[model samples]
Target: MYIDGALTDGQGRIDVINPATEDSVATVAAAGFADVERALAAARDAFPGWAATPIAERQRWMRRLRDEVIANEDDLRACVHHEMGKPWAQTEEDWDRVVASLDFYAEEIARLQDFSLPDRAGTHSHRMVWEPAGVAVAFLAWNFPLLNLAFKLGPAMAAGCPIIIRPSNETPISAYAIGELCAGIGLPRGVVQVLATETYAAADALSASTIPAVLTMIGSTETGKHVIRTGATSIKKYAMELGGNAPVLVFDDADLDLAADVVCGVKFSNAGQICVSPNRVYVQRSVLQAFTDRAVARARAARVGFDRDDDITTGPLINARAFDRIKGLVDRAVAEGATLLAGGDRPQGMNRGHFLAPTVLGDVTETMDVYRDETFGPIVSIIPFDTEDDLLRQANDCGQGGLTAYVFTRDLARAEGYAAALRYGEVQINGVKYDIDLPHGGIGYAGVGHDCSYLALHDYLVLKRITRARDTTLFESVNA
Candidate 1:
């Protein structure tokens, strides 16, 4: 664990397993309650100084960390690749985002300026200034270890807030690798702390503390609720990117090949553990059969393995538990009348790892669990819709809030209408794009605040209004 400007051992250790090999890749320090307290205290102690530091100086430090990240990119990528069994090519996305986030936020923070507010009565001058909120505690999800960390760390650091990061135990090695880089770059004590704890008690200790003024996370909605409930000890700013059951709408006028490629590309990527991965794909009934055929073919073509040089597209699920859960969803969906059009079971000749082949299900109904719930796996549930109204209604009927929605249509009017109608943070028409400079967030149960772009800086910042009475005599004299 990295705490108080140093890398140190904790009371216990966690053995990190490679999901692809089911082998212990590395053993990392696990924080106890005491270690959690120490990290919180360190963040509290460092917040004032860090927040007060010059923005230019802070930018320099951010760049230094980015450079270190680039220098050791191979090692960091290896950590994520081994810890999560993510394909070597997929790990590059995680690594790229880490570098891009730091660079983007560093430049973005420099553009922030106080806003002058007009006084209606003209008696006073007012300015709204942005400042660091205070100490922050970030809880990261395991699916994209470094990418999730980058989402929180870059903005918090750029906004001048001291953050204590608690990465999921399942993927702590990559985050710990980041801590090593921070230590190497000589980041100030407590400005950034990375720790993982096996016990929920220790993890809860950080949330239950009074020091953190901001509680941010990238995880499931249930876990978000738990953090909010436990962290209610203080009124903290919450910016979470929670669970998503994203929907994809493919109209009859759409490009069937493009729709299938994108859906399969994202669905099979990282073994479909992505929050914004298309959960339910609704196709206009006229083209349902055509789209299903394309999707099934793409799923079958996906290469599933652990070989780094094999251009592998799909890798193992994070663990046995995840594998079983995904398989259960597939089995139940089939039992409930959904047709298993493509790969649905573990790939043949792969008996060791928790690997599931890229799966495609057709003739799915709204009543099925796979359609109702977020299927965080390499499975695509295709449901056919007859009308536009029915498609929109079913698309927005997600019990879990909307994060991202995809629309593939050639008609401009139809695309615009769907974009407006879809109740999601992001609505991609005919394509999907995400970057560190683009806003990524959700609504309702999905999450509360933005993760990327300049908007994300607001999560780590507080606004203070300063007003001063106008000098009446000076104004009169100047006018006279």
Candidate 2:
């Protein structure tokens, strides 16, 4: 972990295992309570100075970090693959997004600089200024470690807030690599610190501590709730991107092929571990079989193996725990009478690694656990709806407020209606595209706060309005 702009080691070491081989990739030390304390203290002490730094200079430092990320892109991608088992292409895409986010902060900070407001009637003037929300604590999940870090880091830097990051224990190598890059770039001391704890205790300390004015996390909804409760002690602001059980809605008039192309692409990505991956697929009765057939075909075509094949789209699950859990869900869904249209068991010639067949199920009901739960695996269940209204109702029945939704229809009127009716944060009209300029987050069970776009900077900033009266007005205090 990088603490106060210096390199440091933890008390004890933990083994990082490769999901594909179960082999020890590297040993990382646990950044214990003392490390957490010092990191938080350094961030707290440097907040005033860092936040007061001129925006232009801050941007300069930010660009340097961005340059470092771009320069060491290969190393960063390799770290993610070795530690977390993500495929090479997906890791590359993640870095591309990371680079874009860094560029975004540099570009967006300029527009956020104007803070002056003229007097209403020439008697008073106001200076509407934005101050960085003091020391920020970010909880980075393992699935997309570096990309998730960029989600919080870029905005915080642009907002002039010093930050402390708690990376997931399962994927700490990339976090350490990022720290090395930050240290080498010569960032101001304490502006960025990465905690290398072996457990969640470090995150607990940072969240419950009174130093940080803002706390952001990317994890499950249950975890988000815990952070909310703990952070309330200090009245800390929050930005959380939790779980999702995304549902894809296809109408009778929808283009079946287009819907198939989009759903299959997203459902199979990252071995279906994405937070907003399409899980509960709701298709109209008219095109249900056609969509299901296409999905199953795509699943069979997707390559899964014990080794990293650039040709292989599916990587092994994080570990044995994920493997068993996903298998259980798939098995139970089948037992509950959901038709296992495609894959229902482990692949042939894959007994050593945590590998499962890219699965698809049809004739499912909302009552099934597979439909209601966030199936963070390479499996998708298709539920056909008898009517348009019926399908909309079932989609709304999602308890997690799935973050992303999809609708494929030739009729613009029908698409508009469905888009407005969906409860999720983003509704893709006909396909999938993750753009940095767009805002991403969720509602209901998905949690709250904005994580992308210009709104991300707002999450790390506080607005203050100061006014001066040239002469005493009607409502002005006459005693002063």
Candidate 3:
């Protein structure tokens, strides 16, 4: 655990396993009740001072951290690669996000300034001020360990709020490494703390505490609800990026190759653990066969291996449980009449790792569990549609959440209509893009707040209004 600007021991330790090898990569500190309390207290103690620090000084520290991240890029990448069994190439995205977020937020905070609001009666001058929301507690998901941490840490630090990060137990080694870097830079005590807890009791202690004014997380919707329910001890601000069942709509006139490339690219990346990964792909009936063929070709060509030099595309699931769950989904889908078009079981010649071959299923219906639930694995279910109305209805019928929707079409008018009518937060036409400068969030169960762009800063800030009565004589003199 990293607390009070130092690396310290916890009451217990959790052994982190590499999914590729199913071997213990490292053991990380696991916080107990006492440790959680100490971390909360430290954050409470440091909040005021950290918030009072000048923006320029805060920016300096952020840039310093960014520099450290850049200097130790390889080590950080290795941590993620080994800890989660993520492909070496995929780990690059994790590393890049950490660096980009720090750099982006540091400059973004400097752009913030007080806003002047006009008084309708012209009797007073009013200004809106932004201030740190106070102590923050962040819960991260394990899929993209560093990337998820970057989304929370960058904003909280830049906004001048002290944060305590509780990374998922399944992958904490990378987060622990980040703590070491913070200690090396002499970050202020309690300004940033990273710890993992094995027990739900200790983890709940963080949310249950009244010290945290903001509770943010990146995880499942049920977990988000649980946090808000437990953290209701106070009126705390919540910003969560939860589960998503993103949909992809492919029109008959669309570029089939481009669509397949994108779908396969996203589905196989990180073994399709991404929140915004395309869950249900709806292709026009006329071109259903064309789309599926391309998708299968890409899936069959995807290299699944652990060696860094192998240029691996797909990797292992986080653990045995995840592997079983994904495999069961595939088995159930096949049993229910869906045609297995490509890889479904584990890749041949690989028996030790928790790897699942990239799977593509066709003729899938909404009634199937594979289509109904968010399949956070390397599986793509293709559903065919005859008309735009039916496609729109099925696409928007996402009960899990609506984070993102993709459309591949050459018709600009049709694309614009779908983009506007789609219920998801993001609609990508022809291509997909996500970066630190764009707002990333969703509607419904997906989440409540933004994770990127200047908008994300709102989650860590409180708005204050200051008004002063204008004197009539002073106004007249100024006018003259």
How far residue 186's Cα lies from its native spot in candidate 2, in Å, is 1.8
Question: For all candidates, what are the clash counts?
Answer: 0, 0, 0
- Model 2 per-residue lDDT at 262: 79
Over 4 Å off, model 3? 472-480
CA RMSD per model (angstroms): 2.4, 2.6, 2.5
Report the Cα lDDT for residue 107, model 3.
92
lDDT of 2 by residue, 1-480 (tens): 799989888875778897877888988767778888999899988999999999889888888888888999989998888887887878887677678888998789778864778876898778888889899999988888888888988899889899998888888888888888889988889999987676676668889899999999899988998888878778888898999888888777877888887787777778888987888888888888888888999999988863446787888888899989999988898899999888777788877678788999988887788888888898978988887657777787777476878888888988888899999888889888776777888987786788879988889999999987777564566655
Q: Each model's C-alpha lDDT?
A: 0.93, 0.84, 0.93
Model 2 per-residue lDDT at 293: 84
Off by over 4 Å in 2: 113-122, 306-308, 472-480
Q: Mark the regions of model 1 whose C-alpha exceeds 4 Å error after superposition.
A: 472-480
Lowest lDDT 10-residue stretch of candidate 1: 384-393
lDDT rank, highest first?
Answer: 3, 1, 2
TM-score between model 1 and native: 0.97
On the 0 to 100 scale, the lDDT of residue 475 in model 1 is 69
lDDT, model 2: 0.84
